[model samples]
Target: MLRSVFLLTLCASVALCASEYRVKKASRASLNRLKRLINEKTEQQHSDEKKLIGVLDDSPLLVRDPTAQRHHDELAVNNLDEYFQGDVELSETQVEILEKEIVESAEDSKARRRRKVGKAPLYKRWDRTRPISYDFASSVPYSTRIKIRQAIQLWERKTCVRFQESGPNVDRLEFFDGGGCSSFVGRTGGTQGISISTPGCDVVGIISHEIGHALGIFHEQARPDQSSHITVNYRNIPIGRWNNFYPVSLSQADVFGLPYDAGSVMHYGAYGFATDPYTPTITTTDKNLQSTIGQRAGPSFLDFAAINIAYGCNQHCGYLPCRHNGYPNPNNCSECLCPDGFSGSICQYVQYTSCGAHIAVSQDSVSIYSPNHPYQFDSNSECVWLLEAPPGGKVFLEFEDVFQFGCEDTCDKSFVEVKTGPDFRVTGYRFCCSTRPTKRFQTLGNEMLVLFKGNRERSRGFKARVWSDVSPIFTTTSSTTTAATTTTTVSTTALTTVAVEESTTERLSVAVSHGVSGKEVAVKSVADAGNGSARESVSKRIANEKKNAHATSWFVLQERTF
Candidate 1:
């Protein structure tokens, strides 16, 4: 199951340890030393629109958990690509810059990796917990939505893009739903439109953010290894071959002055589970990615500068990443097409070009995996790799990171699609998608979802509309659900289920628009009935009278472990 997080942007007061990303005197000097390419690839500038400033969370992405924090800590010093072989290249100048970036961008170390890092915080002790779970969202109030909205606006101003609400009938963002699985804004398969749900009923700038994600912008703080100053050693991040993971996508619009921005709203505060948050200075380490320091929250001086360029004030001169072609050519790699380093439709490049861990080049598509759930039944419910499925089937893609999107982050809304059964529909997507890992970089189909059968097992494929990814690579191109519930459906050893337990979970519709989805699940048999006690799987207990009729179908609910 892909881990879910409920970030608590609600603050009772200013955090004492709240620190900003600091720029080291030496690092800054080095950055200034870089020689600009005389014949740099000139990028066409998109007129910057008015700034869209919303309240954003000025915190670091680091959270202290046993598994997650430990993982990050190891990453700080890890070689990253031991499993795969790829040539490392750089002229002396390029090597120097790359090294500096690695230094400034280094993430903190996990408590376990530290020989003498400060002790873990009181709230979360490294030894006490495996995966860190920072308590938040509970204390968040509905009104805070405006602050988050502002943060997003500020982000969009730095990265020009259009953000709007879901279609007329539907609203993508909800104000305050404690549901752990709640996402702020995303391109939904729903026909209504790109949706953004906030904690409360409405926050206008929320659309701007949703649009930003659709544009493939990433959180400023989520940059890889930028927390070494916090005493963690993310440098040790030992990744498999082809192992590249960054918080945001390169294609996504930059929030502002970064490569290092301690004040970037997307930043999380403090080190991973580090109780004592440091107070950062106005200048963060020059290298945004390798700075061995923690950053504080708030808009930095450079922040305003970048936003001014991205979002038009009196002058329009920036960019709004579309789903087509041509993106920020900061490195002048545009003309080289597979330039010195970078590949993909719109040049989705990776610093370490190996997929030893998070992703690997699949014969189909690059496949990423979630931790196997505790109760996953092998063979029957085992996670299945799906290239396609009938709309309203068991699994589907929420975004089109690679297949649909070829350029930088784009939310043209043209690619967002969904289907269920015979009803094929299309709707606009509000947010963005990108291949950059620095921006919490994730691609569509980067994660896997699994579904199970209740009555009988059929391996046949169905179809109606073709949108994106499917599960077990099955042909369940068409399927529907009628929820009455209380039915216990399990698969046998022949099937494998992939997913970890989440406080909240999402059951997706196979179709694009909910209208088609509703129709797909129109059958009267499926009900939302399950044993209240069964935590692992949904249990729908059949009524006593119906149980006596031999059986509705020859389906057996067997529990099998993968």
Candidate 2:
């Protein structure tokens, strides 16, 4: 009987083992099927996103309407759902405050038609004493998270503001994949959501721009003084979209005394909200700056300065002596936050790039040219030349020879920028076309900064002459001038009037020959009264003479010596 019981127990144990093996096999198969379904769904989502991006690319607007399903539907109505001024998301309280301000402003304007003064817009600033808390939603793509982190790093590096991840139930910024790129301006006391659309809003500059709005900074063109810099062409815009071009009152937006920056990333592009793609909705007062208005290259130097001022970052090192309009750096009090094309501990030197130099100006003019002048310059080259004059003196700059580079409306790709204003913090005059500048540039102070940026397109560079003038003479002169009986000496970069002999003849003949090919570029005869002042005649004769009429050939100029 004991032997029979042992055999029965063995049979039962084998049956239990077989049952367990079959159950394990079925579970493995089920897990494999679940993984396959997940992968297929992910692939489909990616494909749909690609198709959406293709549609978005065809639209002229950079920022899309988060509420609309189709791009064209964005223009269907004047007001977007839950959005202010197109892409700014505002809380109910903030919206109420804005509407009240607008109504009051309209009433005030009606009361004072002769002198319109609108109240400042309401802006809630984030607390600067503590680190800004931020977090990502599960839906945010990993790649987008990386871009947001990079933008945060840049802002932290440039300013004194700090940012960190948030804890549970804390007031923080939540980044999620909204239908389009949008964010609330400044802190809203609770969890503020920043929508960073995938694929469409992946650019670093675009990301930084949205973050800028969240930092209590409005659109550059929204400032009260925007009318002085940019003109809004309402005819090119639809009636419903006119609200996008409305200016924020001075009281509403505090600029911290910074100048209006056309290159600010917050500014709209030329064709923004335009009814016609070829026609621009906005035109800059400074025609050269038309292309610079809507740039997504990141924040301008003044943009950073304004943020520092707004957040009280400038107070940290108020006593620090920073030069060239540079402010003391909040990150390191010992250093300074220098402007573009400027560097050094106190910003007393020119920024060093692949090719550049610190040039000293004297009474005698000196020639400066792009690296490899008279030939095609290298791509991706940045050169900065700091022209410093004696104390109480002024620096004069003139473009002499052929000026050629990659031409764009914005000069985004390649250009030559000259910062001649007293405030070095603002963007300088940029020239990118083949046409040489006709007007000479002079600085208000003793210093001038020249920056040359070259991109993928390599073309013949430029030649310029710089000098120091002690007298305060700020005048614009034509490149072509007429004078009598002058001995013209021309070179590749300079033209010196060796001697101007007094001649009795009323007709003065002048000839300018190219230094390279030895070909006569310009020959002219002028009828001037011999009684005219020698100083006037001598100064007028010295001008840039172009060779071969084509921009490819080198240019020579005649210099005036009194």
Candidate 3:
């Protein structure tokens, strides 16, 4: 499973130490010296929009856990003179920037080959013009080779980067079976060896993750801005491994203006470094999204975007607009990254029937229906309706009849969502998928997006209408009981029939809106509200006694004086 080993680190420390937190002046100086060295070769100044602001300064030495033992499969490389993260081996010049005291030594340490100085920048990306080459060691099984091919295909399908078989004499990646799965970030030059240990490091997602590191992107949570989205439960982390929670500085990263994606394959899981089952090492601000932190289901859309951006693949459009909800793809400038709901060259066409018709509201009121409504909607159909109210006014949406899609936690299978404002950053509501009833919804701004999506599961579509609301709406509710039966009369522009049994004390709410005729009857099936609880009860009663089915129920009606 993707969650099983997602973001699991390779190394384990020997013992826990005392709590010693300090920002050493020498460490900062070391970092500054490395930057100065890189700047002399090629000084690349990122635009403000693409820059990452460092939120936390390097500080406090973390206490390693004393009880934890190292995994037998993991190769201990802590003794190396310089390593950027724990896994990536640094160049001779790069290694010199690390403070000597902090660099631990392993028992089997040897003098590494010293390469000539004057390389490109420390974080120099791979050349997109040239293909990355790789060859498998003889020990690698056929299954592992196939998995590696699949991972490469995934990247090729999404990005412009290509992976080719390494020739005998060329400098390329040499995959070998070793202690544990690990790879250097980006191109380290020459023949770089990526280890994929036998038994444990066999999963395709794990291989893809290591490949991602080799492609130049770091862990998603390693970004400095991640703290705002996810909280590090340092207490639950293994002792001496607190440094794993530390993020890289802003100068060391480029966000490219993308939002922090929890579902990215590069993100660590909630229990990634957890010391115990009950404690989680990572927690999200939105608790519901914690499970998504270490999702290794494959690289997310943003991950693909980041790769294209880093490799300079999205240069074709030259800032041309992609209409509708289309995002420009860095790999192909002429193409766009359109969601499932839309299509076309610029994503102007609505492909999925479930994405219903695109209707723009410019008048006082307008109504919309699902594709082939009165009947069930098509499978995999997604409909989007854009509603724009009068200038300086808000939109009021009322669903005269809404069927299909029972309430669930996330309306994942099928549901409608409302987004408010110009950018639609504020989610108005995700309805028909939870306990919350879809009542009349009013937007806070002039624009609102009503999106309806349906899966293969069939259900009668919804019919809704929206109107401009110059001011906010207010409502009054009162109840009165008659002698014969506990009759409740609800009044509005139209008459709505709602039958409630006096014997059973069930809370029933009935909402009615004014229609074209001013005396029209609005019919809302009992199944649409309370997720069919009321409808089930009515069906049971009808099945038990067929005679009472003919007896009509009375509705309390209030005549509008207007």
- Top model number, TM-score: 2
Candidate 1, residues 411-452, lDDT tens digits: the string is 111111121111111111111122211322212323221111
- The Cα RMSD of model 2 versus the native structure comes to 19.2
Error of 1 at 435 (Å): 42
Residue 239 deviation, candidate 1, in Å? 10
lDDT of 3 by residue, 1-562 (tens): 2321221111011111100110011243454444344333211221232222211112211121222222221113232112233344444444463223123322211111111111135455667787887777665677888888888887887788888874322335656665567676677655556767566666666677677777877777777565567766654644334555555444345666666666566766554545663445566654434434554435666677778777767766566466544567656667677543445556544332323333323334556656666577766776666555446877777776556554332233456666553433222244443222345676666766777767647667676777775422323323344433333322223322233323222222212222222333222333323435645653443232222111111112222221
lDDT of 2 at 59: 29
lDDT of 1: 0.24
TM values, all candidates: 0.22, 0.65, 0.51
Candidate no. 3 TM-score? 0.51
CA lDDT of 331 in candidate 3?
62
**Native-to-model Cα distance after best TM-score fit, residue 401 in candidate 2, in Å:** 4.0
Ranking by TM-score: 2, 3, 1
- lDDT for each residue of candidate 2 in 141-177, tens digit (9 for 90 to 100): 8898999999888788898878886433244577766
